[model samples]
Target: MHSYSRLHHQSGHAAILFSLFIPVLFGIFTLGTDGARAIQDKARLLEAVEVASLAVAGQGSDNVDLAKQYLEYYFPAATIQDSDIQIKKINCEDNDRCQDNESRFFEYQVTAKISQPTWFPGNEAIIGFGDAYDVASRSVTRKYHSETVDVILVADFSASMYNRWNGGSKRKFLDLKDIIVVIADELDSFNGYMADKSLKNKLGIVGFDYYTSRYNNNTRYFYSHLICGSNEKECTKTNPGGSTNSVNYSATVRDIFNLNSIAHTPWQKREVTNISSFEDVLLTDDMASLKTKINSNSFNITSGSGSGTAFYAGLIRGAQMIYQQGENPRQLIIVLSDGEESNKNTTQKLIQAGLCKTIFDKLNSQQQSNGDNVKARIFAVGFDYNVNNNPQLADCVGAENVFQAQNRDDIKNKILELITEEIGHLAQ
Candidate 1:
C-alpha cells in the first residue's frame, strides 16, 4: 500500500513537470518563428533601401519619389512611414563626412515596421517583447562628373551626304546637321558639374571631303572650321583670296612708278581660307556660333572634281583639336558620315602618314587605361550607311558605339537618345 501511494505521488510530480515545460517549449518555438520573420523583414528592408538609393543616385535629386515607390513595392507587408524615411544630400569627399552643403552624393534612410503576432499564449507578455518589430537601413549613392570636357564634332561633307534617301524628302546632310544642332543646344543648356565658368566645355568642328577646294589643277585643300572664341563675331577671319594680291607689273617706267593712280586695282579676296590640311576654324565655348558655323560650312556641295569621302582625314583633324586640350579632360568625338571611304588608296596613304592611325590609336589607348576615368570616348553615326556590312568606319571608334539611321527623323531621335544617355551617366 505504501509503494502504491509513492508511485501516485511520483506520477503527480511528473504531470506537474510536463505542464511547466510544455509552455517553455511553446514560448521558445514562438520566439524562434517571430525572430525569423523579423530577420527576414530586416533583410528585405535593406534590399529596398539599396535599390532606392541606386535609383535616386542615377537620376540625381529628382528621383526621391521613385525611391519611395520602390520601397513600397519591395516591402508590401511592412508599413513605410514617410516620417521615418530621410533623404539628404551628402558630401562624401573624404571619409563620408557629409557635413558640407555642397552635395556630391545622396543618402537614403528607411525605417520599416512589421507586425508579427505571438504564436504561444502569453509569450509576448512574459518576454516583454512587442508584437511589431522595426528595421532601419541606410545607403549612399554618388554622382558622376568629369573635371573638364572637350568635344570634337567630325562631320562628313562628301557629295553623297547631299543626296536624298530612297523615299525621304530631306537630304542626308540636313539630317546630319539637325543632329549636330541638337547636340549644340544640349551643351549650351547644360548646368551640371564641370559646366561652370571656370570649367567651360570646349568644342571643335571638322568638315571632311576628298577635296575641300581647288583653285587650280595643282591646288587641293582640306577645309575645317574651329570655333574657340567667346562669340560668333570673333570667330571669323579674312578669306584666303583677300590675304594677297599677285599683280604682274610690266617692265615699263610708267607702270613701276605709278603708285598714286594704279587704276583702282581690285583685290580678289574671300572671307575664309581652306588649307592643304584641315585647320582649326574655331575652338570656343560659344556653342551658338559653333552651330551656325556647322550649318554654313557642312551643308555645302562637294567643291572639287574628285568626289570621295576622306573619313580618316576628318577623324584625324578632330582628334588633333581634342589633343590640344588640358590634360585628363573628358574628351569625346562625334563622327557623322553617309558612306565609307570612297578612296582606299588615299585612305591608306593617310594611314601611313600617321594621320589616320594616330588618332584612333590615341583614342584606343586612352580608353584602355587602368584608371577609373575614361580619358576619351568616341561616338559614330552612319546616315543611310550599312553599318553591319561596312564596319570599318564604326570600328575607328568602337563597334558598340556605332549608330545607324535610315532617315532624318530616325537620325534625330537616335541622337537625342545618345545625348540624354550621355548627360545622365552615373559617376563612379
Candidate 2:
C-alpha cells in the first residue's frame, strides 16, 4: 500500500511538469507561424511600394490616388487606408539632398504602410507587445529632362528632292521644308525649361548638293537673258523684243565655316544670355523667308551635268560645326535625305579619314573620363528613300537611328516622335 502511494505522488509530479511546458510549446508554435506571416507580408509590401512608386513617377502631381490604386491591386487582402499611403514630389539639385519643391527635373516618393495582425495568443495580453505589427516600405524614382543639346540639321537638296509625290500634289522638297518648320516649332515650345543659360538649345542648318562650290569658299553663278542695248529692233532680231528679261547672280557657299550659306538670321543665331522670357525663335516670317530662300531661282539647277549627292561633304561639315559647340554639350546630327550618296568610294574614304571616327573617339574618351555623359548621336530620316538598302548610311549613324517615311505626313509625325523621345522629360 505504501509503494502504491509513492507511485501516485510521482505521477502527480509528471502531470505538473507537462502542464508547465505546454504554454512554452504553444508560444513557440505561434511565433513560428506569425514570424513567417510577417516575413511574407513585408516582402509583398516592398514589391507593392516599388510598383506604386514607378506608377506615381510617370503621372503628374495628382499621383496619390494612383499610388493607392496600385497598392490595393498588388495587395488585395490587406486593408490599406488612404491615409497610410503618402506621395511627395522631391527635387534633388545634385545627388546629395532632395527636398519637396518645383523643378524641371525632379523625383517622386511613394510610401506605404500596412498593419498586419499577429496570429499568436500570447501577442495580445501576456506580453506587452501589441496584437498587430506595422509593415512599411518607401520607394523613390527620378524623372529625366532635356540636357543641353546642339543639333545640326543636314538636309539633302539634291535634284531628286524636287520629285513629286502624293499624286503630284506634294514635292519631296516641300515636304522636307514642312518637316523642318514643325521641328523648329517643337524646339521653340521648350523655351521655358531651356531658359536656363546652361541648358540652352541651338540648331544649325546644312544644305548639301553637287560639286558646284568648294568648302569654305564662295562661288558665284550667273544666269543671262537677252538684253536690248540702245536698239530694240536689233535686239529683237537677235532675241525677242517683247520678252524682257534680266541677268541674275547669286553666290553659293557664302560662308561655309559658320554655315551662313544656308540660313542664319538674327533670330536663328544662338542665344548668348539666359532667356528671361519665351521667344518664338522660328516665327512665321522666319519660315516664310526660309522657304523663299530654298525655293529661289539660285537653287534651281539648269544643267544636269556635275550633279551628284555629296553626302560625305555634308556629314563632315555638320560634324565640324557640332564639335565646335564644345566637348560638354550633347551633340546630335540629323540627316534628311531623299536619295542615296552618289559617290560611295568618296564617302568610305571620308569615313576612313576620321570624319565620324574622330567624334566617336572623343566621345569614348569623354565617357571613360567622365562617367558616361551624353555623346554624339546621329539620326537619319529618309523620304521616299530606302534607308535599309543603304548600309553605309546605317554605318555612318546607327542602324536603329535610321527612319524611313512613306509620305509627307508620316515624315512629320515620325520626326516629331523621334525628337520628342530624344528630348522630352520622362520617368527614369
Candidate 3:
C-alpha cells in the first residue's frame, strides 16, 4: 500500500510537469507555423513587387498609381496601402546619390514595396512584423538613346468611329482621342529621356475618311465630293473625273438591311483639288499641335465629317506627308482601320491600276538616316477585327507587320510597345 501511494504521488508530479510543458509545445508550434507563413507571404510579395515594378519601369512617375494597381492584382489577399509602395524617378546628375541606377549609363530605376499585415512587430520578429511580411523590388531600365524619329498616325475617324465602340455606349472617336493622348505622352516622355535632348522626335497625323482617286488612264481616277455637310452635295470639282463619294456608310457596307448602292456623279471628273489638303498634319516635332488638331473640327463629329473608309486615301496621304519633306527620314507609319475599303474606285480600280503598291513602296523605299540602308517600317492595327478584312493594310505594310487589337486597352498596350521597341528604342 505504501508503494502504491508513492507511485500515485509520482504520477501527480508528472501530470503537473506535462501540464506546464504543453503551453511551451503549443507556443513552439505557433511560432513555427507563423514563421513559415511569414516566409511564404514574403516570397509571394517579392514576386508581386517584381512584376509590379516592371509594369511601370521607365514609364515615369505619372504611373505610380498604375504600379500599385498591378501589385494589388498580383497579390489580392495581402493587406497593402498606397503609402507602402514608393516610386521615384532617379534621374541622376553629378550631385545626387542614385541607388542602382547610374546616370552615366543612361538608365533609371523604378522601385516598389509591399508590406503584409504584421503578425508581430518587425523588431520583435525576423520574418515579419506581427503577421506582416515586407518585400521590395527595384528595376533599372535604360533610357532612350538619341535619335530623330518621326511617328505618323494614319487612323480612320469615320462615322463608324462616331458610333459606340465594341457595342458599348462610349463613342469610338473618344477612344481614338484617348489613344492620341497616349501617343503624345509617350513621345513627350521619350524626348524627356533622350541622351541628346537636341534631337526631339516628331509626330504627324493623317485622319482620312475618304479620298478622291485621280485617273492617269480612262476612269482611272475616282473623285467625288466625299465631304458634304449632311446630305450628298454634287462635287463640282474633283482631281479625277466622274465617280461618287459616299458619306453614307450604311449604303456602302451592303448590309441586308440596305442592299442598295450609291448613285454615280459625273461631275467628280470635272476638276482637281489638292488631295494633300485631306491630311491633318505633316511631320513636325510639335506634339501639342498634333493633339490640338486631332481635337479640332476636322476630326470631331461635325456636320461635314466624312464617313467613307477610303483606305487608299489614308495610305497614300500618309506616305506623301512623310516622304514629301526630305530624301530619307527615320519614320514609322502606323495605319489603323476598323473596316475595309468602302469604295470601288480606290480599291478595285485605283490600287489595281498599280497605284497602291507604288505609293506603299515609295514610302518604304526611303533609306534610314543612319546609312544602314534600312527601309521605313509600316505597322497596321485592325481594331476589333482581323487585319485581313482590310487587304490594303497587308499590301502596304506586308502580312508580317499587321496586328489585330481586341479592344481599347489592347490598343494602348500595343502602341506603347511599338513606341518603346521600334525605331528609337531604349537599350537593355
lDDT of 2 by residue, 1-428 (tens): 99999999999999999888777777777777777787898898888888887765554343467788888886666678889988887544443433233345546778889876676637432332257777899887765555645566777766666667662256666667667766665454433334354555555566665321222223231111112333211122111112232101111121223343231212211211111111111212233454454445434433333345655545655655565553434667778886567655545544554555565555434442357565677778788777656656676676788877777766665555555444536553
**Cα distance off (Å), candidate 1, residue 356:** 4.7
Regions of candidate 2 where Cα sits further than 4 Å from its true position: 1-101, 104-144, 166-168, 195-198, 211-306, 326-328, 352-354, 362-374
Stretches off by above 4 angstroms in model 3 are: 1-8, 40-44, 58-142, 145-148, 164-182, 185-189, 212-277, 288-301, 304-306, 319-330, 340-377, 380-417, 423-428
lDDT of 2 at 152: 67
> Model 3 clash tally?
17
Candidate 1 segments whose C-alpha is farther than 4 A from its true place = 1-147, 166-169, 191-196, 212-281, 302-306, 325-328, 348-357, 361-374, 407-428
**Best candidate, lDDT-wise?**
3
Root-mean-square deviation of each candidate, in angstroms? Answer: 14.7, 15.1, 9.9
lDDT of 2 at 180: 71
TM-score of each: 0.49, 0.47, 0.58
Model 3 per-residue lDDT at 239? 28
The predicted structure with the larger TM-score, 2 or 3, is 3
Residues 83-172, candidate 1: write the lDDT tens digits. Answer: 666766443443253324343333333333334343333443345235566677776555534344566777776666767776257676
Q: Can you write out model 3's per-residue Cα lDDT over 217-269, one digit (the tens) per residue?
A: 34533333223324634333442212553333222222111112122232232
